[model samples]
Target: MNRTLYDLAGADPALRFSPFCWRTRMALAHKDLPVETIPWRFTEKERIAFSGQGLVPVLVDGERVLHDSWAIAEYLEETYPHCPSLFGGPEAQAVTRFVNAWTDAVLHPWVGRLVVRDILDVIRPEDRGYFRESREKRFGVTLEAFVAERETVLPEFRRALQPVRLVLRAQPFLAGEAPAYADYIVFGAFMWARGASAFRLLESDDPVHAWRERMLDLFDGLARRSPGHEV
Candidate 1:
């Protein structure tokens, strides 16, 4: 409905594929909301840093600027209320919030560590040592030590998700039979830290893997576009 914001953000700003960015892009694509993308470099810190809280995927909506994925999701939901509700239903909104929060708190950190383990191959060779070293500094351990620590955290994540398995059977999306804001949020986080990072921890024939495919299918254009093509 709002074409001006998309018009201004016509270029893909960031070179990296962030899950949060992917989620917002997919959200817009799903609803057929025409928003343009501004691909930003990490070096362009001043502009986006001030607005997006030092992050990518900041939506320039005409005069209004949206920061954070949650805020963006809420904006889209409110802006396009009729287009296949992202919240799915009134009750499911709470579920979406929980799942999104869960991904941030539990899943993301470990995924980040796992990603840093093999950063040497992924990033520029010059940045490799720093990337690997940052994980050590953050986790207070080497890759081997971090992996052991990850095992401890991952089981809890896997277990916490245990209760949701049953609900998932009936409701393909996290909120219910349909997808919701939370599904997009969690899906984006996972897609970024795991999918984009291509972390080994995420590589499995697990339910989460299955869940990823299911969530993407809930939307239209995003599901069709290969990861990291347009938005």
Candidate 2:
């Protein structure tokens, strides 16, 4: 394939579940780009060694290789100007960067606290030791201990989502009327949770939940068709 993406996956190869990868996937769909995605596992770092990194969401387009999801999105926007824009304009791109940073720093950690333990069950058997050790070292605690109070902390996660909720309450999408990179940035976290855990992260009446439903319905149920919980 001319355009290929190494997407993080679970034991089931069809389960492409990385939040970062989801960002890239949504960005690609937004740009009206076609890509062949290869399912990748955590322990398979060497598989993506060509990108000079261990992370998935590696994109190889023709001779150019890109690793970071944000970089890949930018590349797509610049390369395919004729296609739909991921960010509306320079101003939109600047604001979307803040959304990206927030998703990485605040939202991801909250989602991780809720679903990190459950991730072990979906990952490949060989990747289990590496995942647990790496995650434990990063968090300085065992997986079970890390997510032990997921139920109690669910409220905190929901509380942290107030910013997005507030924005959604006013606008249909983070980038105004139409979805953009900002929407993908936040929705990626929800996709991560949906793919790995059965946890209900939002309430039915929540505006955030409504936004997520619209996101899942995008690209003709691209995300909803994935193997994940209804919530």
Candidate 3:
């Protein structure tokens, strides 16, 4: 245990990662804060109940349990005041919120749907049945039926990304010079889509692509001893 709030949340390393948590984890890494990761299953309401919510990425500091991703990010900033700005300045807040909303409110649902078909669709027949059954249990549907059914979420997802893609075309990071909590929160969802399955729509030269590569560099650039693990 790191003897912090982070440890109480994620005791298992492999299970500790979720994109939402990953964003903050990456941010903490960016700021060089020592954090412990807690992994919880989507179906495991006990974990949620423990934290008084049904979400992963809960941060457990010495005595505080921070739930929401953004709030946690802010807490880290305030707690570790020595680091440079993460949310950025006056106008930066708007841009930061914009990027976060675009990903969570828009791109994620679509990406989730696409991955089920594109990535989980590739699961072996027996495993596919189990995976789909599990998904349907959490999301709704039977394995045999879900694949046979068409996802209505597709069109809406593409429509949502339109503006987001437009924004990415203007700058590599949503916050401009470098990534902020805003870039990470949004990128967290995109990372899910990218890792789970391929995004055909992403190939169009949006700053989002550059941002992903940039994150990899940032993850690799620093030493683990200075802050947290690199990536």
Q: Which candidate wins on lDDT? A: 2
Which model, 1 or 2, shows the larger TM-score? 2
lDDT to native, each model: 0.58, 0.92, 0.58
Per-candidate TM equals: 0.71, 0.98, 0.69
Q: Residue-wise lDDT of candidate 1 within 1-231, one digit each (tens)?
A: 333221111123233445667677767766767775665533345667547475666777767777677787788788778986767656666557777777778656746644545333434455446546766788788856665565566666556556446566666766665665666766765555432344344435666667776765654535435433211
lDDT of 3 by residue, 92-170 (tens): 6556766677667666666666655544533334445545666789767653354443355455555666665576677
TM-score of 3: 0.69
Any runs in candidate 3 off by more than 4 Å, and if so which? 1-17, 117-159, 198-201, 204-206, 221-231
lDDT-better candidate, 2 vs 3: 2
Task: For model 1, state the Cα shift of residue 200 in Å.
Answer: 4.3
- The local lDDT score (0 to 100) that residue 194 gets in candidate 1 is 38
Q: Model 2 over residues 1-231: C-alpha lDDT tens digits?
A: 499999999999999789999999999988888999999998888899999988879999999999999999889999999999899887789888999999999999999999989999999899999999999999999999999999999898899999998999899999899998899989999999999999888999999999999999999999999888887
Off by over 4 Å in 1: 1-16, 49-52, 89-91, 119-138, 141-157, 197-205, 218-224, 227-231
Looking at model 1, residue 29 earns an lDDT score of 67
